[model samples]
Target: MKKFLLVFPFLSLFFYAGAQNKNLTMQDAMLNARTTLAPENLSQIQFVYGTEQYVYAKRSGNDVTWLTGDFKNKEEKNLLTLVELNQKLKAAGRTELKAMPVVQFNQGADWILNIQGEKVAYNPAKGSFTTLIDAATAAKGNVEQSKAGYTAYLDHFNLFVANVADAKQVTQDGSSDIVYASSVHRDEFGIAKGTFWSNSGKVLAFYRMDQSMVADYPIIDWTSIPAKNVNIKYPMAGQKSHHVTVGVYNAVTGTVVYLKTGEPAEQYLTNIAWSPDDKYIYIAVLNRGQNHMKLDQYDAVSGNFVKTLFEEKDEKYVEPLVPMLFLKNDPSKFIWQSNRDGWNHLYLYDVKGKLLKQLTKGAWEVLEVKGFDQKGDNLFYVSTEESPITRNLYVLNVKAAKSRRLTSGFAVHTTQVSTSGQTVIDNYSTPEDPRTILLSEVASGHSKTLLQAKNPLADYNTKASEIFTIKSAGGDPLYCSLYKPVGYDAGKKYPVVVYWYGGSHAQLILNSWNAGAGDYWFRYMAEQGYVVFVMDTHGSDNRGKAFEQSMFRRVGDVQMQDMMTGVDYLKALPYVDADRMGLFGWSFGGFNTVDFMLNHPGVFKAAVAGGPVINWNLYEVMYTERYMDTPQENPEGFAATDLTQKIGNLKGKLLLIHGMQDPVVLQQNTVSLVKSAVDKGVQVDYMIYPGHEHNVLGKDRAHLYQKVTDYFMQNLK
Candidate 1:
């Protein structure tokens, strides 16, 4: 990928000429960008990744068919082609038919499909479908099938149990306001997985989230009649949160028991897991502020709190419950990732939350825990031990406490380890290479090429990326990447633009594939007599939790300090004009950019802050509270970090861009900043995309980038 970028000077020139249309509309700009930034089909999906079997609904020879893979092998035979299966049911006197594929049966004999909201067992051999459970009106959670043919679901906000013979609702008190079976907040943005199927699949445990008492944050959509308002029960920073509880349902007896959490409604219950024997449930509970966490166990049947297995406390804030690792061979044993030891490391723990051993200990943080091997002894994870700016795969032995580096090379590797941890699909690139995908062995490190994206911009004449390192005023090393324009000269000084995100849990300077717009925008700026630089500061991602958590309580201070140091570093460069430096960023990056311009106005001549969080007090609780704590507790910190409060000190030509309907960093943030600047008699440029959200999607992004580029050129140049 790096070589392609380096060699494609001509292609870059052609793209630049074609893309540089002054009168182009926002739609046209987006269309042009998409044409250049076409994504590749990697044959990866949510459930079935890298599988030859293509699951699709198609019409075949007068019959609608549902097929998985090539229908050559008997085991790979048709689960059910829609037309034939429906005709057979119609011939059996069942006219109304609706079948949707559910969970894949372990033995691959048949798939559990939903028909009219009821689970049914469809046999390919008999061409028949039998009703396993009766139809219900509410949404059904994933079905759990036991070896004894018992099935269960979270129907009508409560657990429902059934066997091959009959079905019954296990829980009685379930309503729209009181949900018992489904995950709250649509399971996105750090919601824990709800279903807990035992090892034998005979018992099931599920989460019940009650949001009746929580206040709703109204989301107004003008597209609907009378302007529809979606009342999202959002837990904003320092706000009342939803209460979550766990319940165990017996598949054979049709009984349910609610686990006792003892924690108040404001607390969170997450990472719930059931024991192998279905005797106990383990859960991680955190307070509203998210500074303290407790790993608790409960009796599955008796609904009694057993004991506190482990506790983690932080002076700043403890991280919320991420997904936990459970051993397949010994369900009593599990693995945990924590920053209590000052670095994110893996720890082996028993069901009682007793520390069995420390698996991996180092300064590097484990990016992900990608399942255990077949034996459940070795754990596969991605880490940045090689370089803070790069990620690579690693494997650790649970019992031996030994670890091995899986990928050792210059290119940065992001990997997806298979469920068995034997095979990995590694995607990597560097400054000198294009993105190349490889399938490699976890233990042996042998790999085969899968896909190497051709550099479509190879024919464009462009300058190459120059990598450099700078030491901050505090003597901490910061990695920076500089992009020079095509056909450069050393005689004349050029305007320098610093693109930065300088936030906790983020890294911008990386040896990886670059998007066409990003590359073109940077290259174009350089081509137009501007120097482009991106620096990854100390409080960035991939480094362990300590480095990221350094910004706690002082969100914008340390990052700005590092960025100002980078400005000094750039000012020292012979080719960069000290007076012509600009900064731009989106979201958290935008917050940094604006805050820097306001607080340290002398360092930046121009800045563009897009979709910024002007005030921490307005953000959501889960993410904001983790880093800044509750505003009630840290009032001074919140007041000091508020960009709107510091707008009076703005010195730069600032362009404030925002999406009108941005849900993450709401549009009100931009409005507040603009109002503050106006009240202080400060001049600022502003633009808003009407129907856009936090990110300008499709063609809007092109218009956005162009707008940003034009603004920087006009102001900084």
Candidate 2:
């Protein structure tokens, strides 16, 4: 703990740390954070679901161990020891799983653990101990397994289906305007878990959603006791949208079906794959001006419509996020992902759609697939081909079609693979290495570290960043980073703060590790002395698909002409103060810190903006019609990123944080920009949070970065 700050010339800087003598606090910048300054990350390497035969566990000050391995029988064991599964959950009175629970193995290696709220089923080579669901009969977010031993969850609001000795309920109309199973369009394309199973889970498929023809939106609940509106069904943007159907069920014929997926049941039937001979399923649909798409293929025990194998239109939309990958033992080819060749490559197709070749082309942008290498003849992905802010790891030989680069590390990797792909694990990071993990050997990339982590800010006052590259006004280049204010003194001008996020899937500096250093309150406002920068404009996020469709339909014109080429590299930084500069962001970096401080007025004097989107006809309709193509067809690109039609062209000192339950850019977008800055008398500075949503997260995000470091040290120090 080296802290310092003590300035005192009759000091009066209000809870100061300003001209950084050093020290830190807003609860040491949000509840004593800086704990090891971030690097201990091994969040995933488990592999027992669909087998690569892994296990992993490792703990020391009390010894935990598990281990397991087996990349094609290089074998290694241990397997059951988290203090002997907490001494068999303290001899079954349960509750001791505490830290290592996600080890889930099933096809014979018997693992399934879940502990505290119970769902046991252990086996470990016959140490036998079955309970599998019974935390007083399970219910909250229920359960959901299925490697044939079925589990499918949810009870209050029906839809069940247990296994370790029968349970089955399967929806009795849970009503409250029909839900059953959960997650729907609101969760957008990735569609987080709403069940799905098949290929041996013996039919499950889920997601029902009916939202009784939309329209509710009240949400008042100020911790109640007279404050209680709470309606929430909000479909907004041209409204009335929720219908989603997918059902199926069966669990050995308890019966259910549903997927006809036809009609205007409010379009968007998303990715949802299946077809490993579980009598077919697939879906991809989309149509609701989400510019056509039609991957279809249904009939899982008579849900019908088994046809349309290919289609993908897009005047400005057709999104279809991932779900084709089949080919693990060839159920008749698969692999699809597309940006329709503007970049996001990979096409292979089969099962009657024909195209069979296009496995990976480039401008760069594959991003993730990580599977098949166990006799499927190679294929493992993760790319930007090397820099869309970095992420590497390749392989692709699905019949000598070519592809190679298995991580020559600059960082941002992220592997796992193993089931005869011949080892992988990886887990990377890097603008200066803060997470290692190795394990390697996918055909000689060769390695073995298996865990590194330990930096969590090693003591503090952090700051050493530099990763360069600028040139944007259409000449491209971008990627920036900078840091400059940690005990610096280039004749001291200081101030500066930047931290943007120029949208389109976002990418603020990367070569992984410290490059994703994350804006820890701009590293606690560069330990409170400022000058922090971070760039990647021109529609960030893994560059490809013509660099994220270059702000199509003008979303803040190439993000303020690439943040005015980062304030002309911070007014040619001579220790950079440039009129005390400042800027930060939240939702779309609070709509680019108020659209680049009102379209570059004075190059930012002060700024904050959490949860901002000041109107694109109030956001959603599958992401503002795939990048602003609807305010009745880009009315001048939604009247130029519509910041409430440029909120009186805002000048400076702007704050406006929001989240009085922001269901995605909506606290009526800063109460309609403070009622259009009180009908243009103009003067803003707000903060809301209450029961937050769309962010201002936990520990109230350290009182939202101590009210954004006391409004940029009272308006840019």
Candidate 3:
């Protein structure tokens, strides 16, 4: 596998006006830079499997129009060309295109394409189409069909009804923002799965988030008339959060009942699951601080809270409830993940909340719940049992409670099992290996490679990466990888850049082949004579709940200690110059850089802290309260770790950069730190990227990386 920061340092300084012997526009610079950093291959690598067909929008090369495609077939098949499809509708005498086209399957009926705006349903087998609902009526959410089908579409959310004759609206109050029947986060990123649907699809339980109460952080478009502000309802840390309410809707009666939550308005109502019989709803409610969690069962019909299934309290903090299973077809029996036993493990519980068995007992944490097999005898999941830095697939007999590792290798493996649990798609990569995607039989362990990403930088003549294990000051072994420069020589020492993000609940060192934007940037930096190293410090995630919560009350102490040990380990390497080392990070990484630079200045010559949280007081209640407790309760600890107090201790050359409109870490954090440092006569270079946010996205990121490269070359070189 290739390290991320090994490719682009020479391109970083190509922007300097004084060094500008050649004319290079921003576009030219980016195009030239991307040539050195582009991934070797661009192919559809399997990430995960879902119940629905893989539908996504793509750009057409011919006319630069948007087209939708379905990834179910082996070959890429365009569902429709927007222009041609629109022209066909215009010929059919349709004035408007309201809803997009959707695919539906039925046992007796042919495959159908339901087109919005056109209000037409096309049957592929019959070669005929019919208008199901008028465009104006469909826009008003008045469409409905009897429920016995393999798939059914109701307004925005879809469902599979057992009896089409008995089907009705499960939710009545769903709108643009006030959605009740849909999944959260739009089926993108991690939180793609929906809340819950009954075994027979009779009762549909979902989360209705009231984001109207939350403030809309605007993203402005300069091209629009008067520069229209795109208001995004973003819930920042310590700020007013969106109110979440769980609802159990009856599809037969078209009635929606909100589950009774005794807690205050801002509490998080998450991890909702319905019983097999659809009589009761299970929900996990956590306080805004996220320390106290209560799992309650409610009557689906009456909307009355029946009893608390389980209550977990953590001295440090309790994580959001991660539900493993609803016990196959038995809703009364379920599996829940908890760290109350010091390590994150699975606990089987009866409907009455009595602990039935401890399904998984270990020091390591289960990374994913792959669901149970057909027999309901075996449970498959991913875990970091072998090492904290690496992940592998595993299976356990639910009845016998006997566990066995399914994957045997040092590389990090991420697996996604099919709904049947018979087949799995396993993708893995190590520091020295390219990523390989494989299809494997879960029971037999037979596998076939689907795609192997070619090493994109093979032609770049980059040096190899070395993996090492360094023990922290606390005796915990930390896994890290070091990327040597392209022309590394044993006799000549290279300036080291320790890329750090020692935040709780984040893993930096992984043996995955999918390199992100930051990883590519890191690789480019490494190619420029900087030996880049990344370590998963003490407070980082994927170890277990205890290891993750270890930084509570004492935010920077353990992480800094572990990072110092990593620095010491780096200094021992023959190719590293200990005195010429530097650090760079963003967000929590930025926080780590600022904390380390202030507490241990002599170790790093130059440091960059981008969008760092200088004080815990500025952060939000939900996230900050979980790890650090309330600032009032831990004033001493907060003061000790606060970056503002340690700004005067700055001894290294530092550069502070921030996006002017960052909502997560807020640009105010960087501004405050710089102001404090300047007031104390501490010299620090600062840059503000106008209209940027927590991330310098799009073309702005290229410019940001260039600036960072220039900073490192000027100070560390």
Candidate 4:
């Protein structure tokens, strides 16, 4: 691939010869960046179920008015108003809504909404509402409602099913250690929720995690009087992990049966899916080693092991994130995404696990599988076929095995296909463009720009932003982004602040708004006369498996090498001050910042790391074991990346920050390093947010940024 330096043309909208001059305040940059400083968006923009018309909400005064438009209509019309919607709510004996709740049109032309925690159906024509699922019954979270009007939720740790009239407890043995109807495996393998509702809503499958064998880890709450210890079950690498099982609940008979997975009991059962007919359930069962995975089927009613459809084995690791997407028109066929062939691609399989066809194949990976058309003939998806940093929409003709790009340009696009799949809404953004939404016809590829959002920072003077690629040490292209200081001068050198998260399952640089900085902090620093830089190293996401697996058994080695390649590029620039460079990152990036400063001493003059992982052994079992294996099996690899062991070599000004309540990367990781710094007679600064979690969110986040800025200014600047 040829490399090119592409300066975003859309920057001209915000940067000009003499338009305005305004610098970002700390509060605006950190707290309100996603709100006041964020780009304008169409609220609740979606296709009305089974209709060509799409609706969006626009604020009128204190309330919003719902508006609808279609390709044929071309003119927007009012769909509903707060006053009328409230009248209906009052007539139905419900509390009148002060504001318009997020409403979705159902197949019957009625709207479905979750109002006051209850799933209700509103008939716009009749101006009435019928509660589909009662809110009082759903006292706990993890709520899931089936089409059959049955609701499932977790009360305490036990699973419960309820209808409009009554409720029933499905599990009686649930306790603090024995969890049910909740996410398992620390929410790995893309398991966001535990409840799985079948097509007809006849059966509900949920996860049962037994953590009695795991060790207890304490998270101190300093806010309490004299402080308090909250113990949580945290399974570490090379330690005994929690055992998990699947339970099937029959809504008709009110009986539960557990699947006979049969194993060492510590294996991971991920990607749970129900058959279209609700007769069988499929699970991607991965072993403790994570190198082998079996796609197994079980009878949903009896909980008997049906058969092992197929198995996938990888020398490094076999990770199955997405569940099987069964075809609606043909229940016997399904689409499975895997990286078995070195890239994440879609494979068509029959009920017997026989390969029907490979739906997609290439160097680029499919980022998401949207859904099929009303006829289930064509499939919609998002991928990086255009460029690794850009996500574009594509439509695949399943029968012909052909794909066509429905979206264009080198930008990130998130799409929503219509009910009939004849039209789609593409919401995209570039470094220059904050947001641009287009309504396009999938058949003709003709599109009309629905809205072109004005730059939120257009009135404020901003510097130039560039998105390009650089060659890594191994000659692979590393995507990079740079935000130059305001009023940049070619002859004058300026201090540089490098922000990065060089870890798996994340990408820092993209051809999107603000170069995917995600906040105004980078621009805020640039306005302070510091060049801000970010690079997506080889191990980052959206790249193929080989690119990511290059760091297998050695997490920080390849990432640091690629990051140094970016640093070298910065140092070579005439306007970058090589003598005064600093680093900042959070979580995995925090680990990288500390690792880089220690491993490559004197490279960075100052650094700040938040929630850094000092040792792999202290991290969770599922994520750490996948990348670094168990500590017993790869002690040498673990020893190489351990920052506490290399604290004595630290030469730069280092500040470690942690959220005391962070359960993800426990505060212990940073405290252990603080202890090691004392042992090594090295000076290390530290700060802790008493009530914050892995991330210091809301207004407190501004304080975190202030501390970071002050550290860089006092030490490096």
- Per TM-score, the best of the predicted structures is 4
TM-score of 1: 0.79
lDDT of 4 by residue, 460-552 (tens): 767546777788777778887788888889999999999888788898877788877778888898889999888888778988998989989
Q: List per-prediction Cα lDDT, in the order shown.
A: 0.70, 0.75, 0.66, 0.88
**Candidate 2 lDDT over residue span 477-590, tens digit each:** 777777666677789898988878788766777766556755456567776788888887877777766667678778778888778877876887688878988888788878
Q: What is the C-alpha RMSD of each candidate to the true structure, in Å?
A: 6.6, 24.5, 8.0, 1.9
lDDT of 2 at 323: 83
lDDT string, candidate 1, 1-717, tens digits: 011112222223222323332432334335543454433324331112333233434444455444444212334345355556668778767655554334333224555566666666666557677765656522456565566566666665666766756678877787766776666543532564566777667777777778777676665776777877666565667877678788887776667788888857677777776766778777778777677888888898788999998898887777644656778777778887787887777888987668998888777777777777767878778877776666788887877999888886655787766555667767777554456766676667777665677654454444446655667656656777777644567877888888888776567766554421233567566666788888777667766666678788878888888887777767776878888888988888998888888888778889898989899887777778778888998898889878888887988799989886677777778888889888999888999887788898875677888899889878887
Q: Give the least accurate 10-residue stretch of model 2, judged by summed lDDT.
A: 1-10
Ranking by lDDT: 4, 2, 1, 3
Q: Candidate 4 deviates by what RMSD? A: 1.9
Candidate number of the best lDDT: 4
Q: What number of clashing residue pairs does each candidate have, in the order they appear?
A: 21, 11, 25, 0
TM-scores for the candidates: 0.79, 0.32, 0.77, 0.97
Worst 10 residues of 4 by lDDT: 1-10
Candidate 3 residue-wise lDDT, 612-709, digit = tens: 88887776556676778776778887788678878888888999998866767766677788788878988998988877878887777778878988
What lDDT does model 3 reach? Answer: 0.66
